[model samples]
Target: MASPRPFSRYEFLIAWRYLRARRAEGGVSVMTWISLIGITLGVMALIATLAVRAGFRADFVDTILGANPHSTVSYAPSQVYNELTEETYFSPGTIQDYDALAARIAAIPGVTRADPAVRGKVMATQNGQRGLGDVYGVSAEAMAALPGVVDPERASGDIADYDRGIAIGIGLARTLGVGVGDRIQLVSPDGAQTAVGTTPRIESYEVVYIFSAGRWDIDEARIYMPLAAAQSFFNREGVADEIEVFVRDPERVDDWTPQLLSAAGERGQVWTWRDAAGSFLAALDMEDDVMFVILAILVLIASMNITSGLIMLVKNKGRDIGILRTMGLTEGAVLRVFFLCGAFTGVIGTAAGVVLGVALSLNVDHVMAALNALTGGNAWQPEVRGIYALHGELRAWDIFRAVALSLGLAFVVTIFPARRAARMNPVEALRYE
Candidate 1:
């Protein structure tokens, strides 16, 4: 084992002095400036890219949670029956039991509310235009309990009237040329047969309110009506398709899902939004990972510039290095001196980059706005789904990761040139000068 040397303040001072003298030398090469600019740009790109990814991830999660219930319970495929003619679907049957189950689920820790829901795909038509939409049948109280649905103007007494009253998305209303007070026809795939064979059961509904969820898929493909009306329309009187549960903390939804399933008494399956919306979330994660890797390559390339700059410094100061060695400075001390110089260059460049990057990331929206204005409002909007506009969220961990990676790269870049400077023979260096 090597003995530990006493710390020397003078050694550090010597290192700093050598770095300052090199920096002040006349005719400093353009390569030095290029190195600094490279680092700055690399850091800026990394920060901006990560910020955008973080923003999109956050916005996507919020949009999904906002438009759908937190968790859902349904019968698993081939496990429990879902046929409209099942005994569970008759009057005075399992549909009435949902109220008791909802109460039981509500009593579970972290569970905020639970409601029965009926879901189906149906074709909606107004005038001559027809579009496919997801139909949800929910009780008036359940609709009120939902976060974004009820408002003063939109609320009409009780949700029971919602049996004949329906809420449609703004985009769908526009596409179909329908508005509040307009009647729309609904055709359910699972409607009861009238006589001889299959019959198209048709019902007209009055549009009561229009909502815009900012998500194109949801806003253009959903309609809400009372649960009983939907059950009657489908001829499934007693059973709901699923039970929707809202939780106090959405982050703990996975934890609560199993508990609710266990409480569902063996006839139902539980599904969290993480499961229902898995593909979208997975795509967002993959995008973030790929973007980060690409941006990190920029920083890696910048670190190479630091390495080249240090090599140039070593070449320019050969005679000075010879003099310092002749003055009894050890090779280790000489190495430390140039290493400090190179490392300090990295530190400064990386620090400046971090500051600039953070500023840009924090104000990305403003930057986008400025660009839009500069282009006379002709700038193309970012192609983002499920949100109103692009956003940037600066996470503390992301900033920390970027800084740490940059500093580490800078340190690694200093090593090779620092080693070469340490190994130079004083006699040969002086004779060459």
Candidate 2:
């Protein structure tokens, strides 16, 4: 008679029967279940972690770009920081023609908005409360164009008379117990010199608006006053401390740098957002790599359980393997049959994990809200998290990575056990039986 083809119908039929273990094979069945559960949990956790990491990074970068300038121009060297006020003190006429320089830069092709500003740190006082405030002196038009602030959704007051009043952060407003229409005092230490000494310049402006910049640090420390008012406050009349430049695409900072310099001419040098935040962005990338490595190890550990289970199955089925070999089954067919059993378990487990992980990512926010409500505590504060809502971004790459990791591990570990069963000595295996 002709030898049976590889993995013939009878071989599959026999493999299926063997997988449905009898009372004598109860221990093998338990091992199979444990292996399947382990793979499923590992894949699920890996995918979920990736989704959360991706979401967090995207949200953080978006907030940074939205609430802050993409680039800054000042009458100082590129190495000089944007917050440096000493540049203005040393070279009073370096950026004296700020209005014209700003207009020129604003007309650049990729430029969106170029707003002259004066930034300073001062003491804020209201209702007997005191806190340090980061004050920005910007024009009414620039203040209106400021992204994330003066928004109808987040702002509590109007900017109709912005020059006559100030726009403060909601966090700062809360801290100082001030609200729209209330007066808050800003005390600057850099006042005009007198015969005896310099006195603190104390000025109070009505709160025209209260805005949230979506960042706890910014919302807790920023204040926006009119350009002319800010100039006078900083003793910088007819000149701006610096000009903030927003672009159409922030990633094109390098491309726009030359054009910005040309527009700035001899007036000022360009300082990019990256100069201010590159280190922080690099740190985030490092964090992502670390998280991925840690979670991948979890998958590796979980997949090891498959090795134990398959070894047990091979040992318990030694007698059956001997009978099959004597009955004309090829060694290759025996290996294929056992391989299918393990492969089936891994594929099914991985599919179920993908489903569970995706579902969890999609409903993470709702889950967080439900848990917060059930616990009746206020631990998840936007001010603490720097974002108003939690988000999870599921990606195709994440799912593929999880599936490939699980399936690859399953196939590799299945090899030795399947080969062992195939190479069994029929006489020796049957002698024990």
Candidate 3:
């Protein structure tokens, strides 16, 4: 016979022929299909899981930082270092020129808006139910801008319309058994001293509006009123506890934080929302990493099927391997033939998995909504809502990483069996069959 055709072309053709052969023709076996299915399922799970986690984090973070300022500029007494315990005391002695300070911060390139606010704890009691909550003093104009925090559209009365009118969270209203036109008694934790000793400042505020920020923590434990009203009520006027700054890109708060802090000078300290929520966000990141590793193990387990299937293929194709070797098929070409068998399964499985996973991730919200409807429950929403609501978002990097991990593992697992086939002695392989 004339010289055998180039082994390169023949190697691929033979591998494809073997892969496509029916069981009757001693072709593609059940184990091959098992490996393909296993890889597809593994990759799909990994991609979808990671995408959901990423989406949940993005949605939750955005809801929080969007409703709140990206950073804050505060000037408190040096002795009050602990925010959790020490009350924010902005006495006239500690007060700074808020207008000038805000103007300076607003002048920053990335800074979009700056507003002064006073935050303090107050007790709310209505309809025999009582609870402690945080009260924020903000401008009516600023209140109109953040609907999640205080929606102007939903309010029947302006925060400045009434001296003691306030916007309350919807959850708080429910808990207090009150409504938009109801009155709630507020007792400031720190109030004026009296002959009876240091008594709490007590006042009544009409609930002009109710806001639902999709977070139970904020909705049930926070309220907002005009800065002027808060100043008069808290007995601290011509001053604010802190100046809140909003930047164009909240995600890049780090880039603008230092500059804003510098403008505030030594009298003020800067705090980004990220810094405030660092521990919670860090826990989320750690959870994502752990999930990735755990899901990656699923792909690794699936790849074992590729290894087993390839070994079985080599055994079944022993006689064919011997004949090919006798016909001048180089050992490397033999190795490549078996390698291609496993690689094709991996490639096809990974591609299918990626498509399915991405599709699921993109539409997961709708899917969840449907499931919840069917189940007659609010399964899609959080049981213990905090600073944000539940939502889904698919990131490109998540898919890329999932696909890379799956394919890389699939390709690596084929090496051992391919080498075994290449090292087989032609005489022994042929003698058995």
RMSD of each: 4.8, 4.3, 4.6
lDDT preference between candidates 1 and 2, better one: 2
lDDT of 1 by residue, 260-366 (tens): 87888676678898887789779888988887788778888888886777787788888978898898777888777777776776777788888888888888888
What is the alpha-carbon lDDT of model 3 when measured against the actual structure?
A: 0.80
TM-score of 3: 0.88
- In model 2, the number of clashes is 0
N/CA/C clash count, model 3:
0
| Cα error of candidate 1 at position 166, Å | 1.6
Write down the RMSD of candidate 2 (Cα, Å). Answer: 4.3
Deviation from native of the Cα of residue 187 in model 2, angstroms: 0.8
lDDT at residue 103 of model 2 (Cα atoms): 94
The TM-score obtained by model 2 is: 0.88
Per-residue accuracy of model 3 over 218-299 as CA lDDT, tens digit each: 7778788889989877877788888888888888898987787688887668889889888988999999999899989988
lDDT of 2 by residue, 34-127 (tens): 8788778888888888888788777776777766788988876334444655553244433678889889999999899998889889999988
Q: Residue 155 of candidate 1: its Cα lDDT? A: 34
Q: Rank the candidate models, highest lDDT first.
A: 2, 3, 1
Model 1: number of clashes?
Answer: 0
